[model samples]
Target: MPWSAMRRVIDVSGDGGNNSGPPVEQARGRSVAERIVINGLAIAKDHPPFAYAGPVPLEDYYREAVIGGPGAFVVPAEDFNQFASAVRRKMIREMAGLPSRPRMALAD
Candidate 1:
């Protein structure tokens, strides 16, 4: 991005938490210091062979680790099938620069 831009935003979404990287809070803090906004869209699963269906919920992890800055949000996708719509809504909010809202999860 251009250096003249007012705000730099990085949207990060994943199925796992800070497993191998530095502590999530550290990265989030660094991004915040740089005046960069971070948002999260976590695709969590109810049950199955997928690794997402583990002990810790991905949504909670994202809310704690990946989301920061003003109006940041973490959209949760409880069902894998609804992942597309979750991404759509998240993208809309990010592109529109909408205000932060309560966490939203796509229903089955």
Candidate 2:
């Protein structure tokens, strides 16, 4: 099947904001314009080894500057320790076609 026949989703997973690239919001705008959904898996840490270029509240940065298109949203994982489950949950929701809701998934 052609890619156009399926949902076009870009999973933007990162430990920091867009450090080296075109402005994230501009890229998101371009993707949204193309009818592509952009979801974020932000690995927010209490003490990041590297400096984050964007504002505080990484999830908020993702929501505003990274995610776009219908039902686009962000899922935050506190650290790499939680990355696997966060990804699992994100994939489940996306595959299930669940409506977007900005909420952290507590580890089970």
Among these predicted structures, which one has the highest lDDT?
A: 2
Q: Give the TM-score of candidate 2.
A: 0.80
Q: Can you tell me which runs of candidate 2 are displaced by over 4 Å?
A: 1-3, 51-53, 98-108
What is the Å distance of residue 12 in model 2 from its true position?
0.4
Q: Highest TM-score among the candidates is held by which one?
A: 2
List runs of model 1 lying over 4 Å from the truth.
1-3, 49-56, 98-108
Q: Write the per-residue lDDT of candidate 2 for residues 66-94, one digit (tens) a residue.
A: 99999888999988899999999899878
Estimate every model's Cα lDDT from 0 to 1: 0.80, 0.85
Clashes of each: 0, 0
For residue 13, model 1's alpha carbon misses the true position, in angstroms, by 1.2
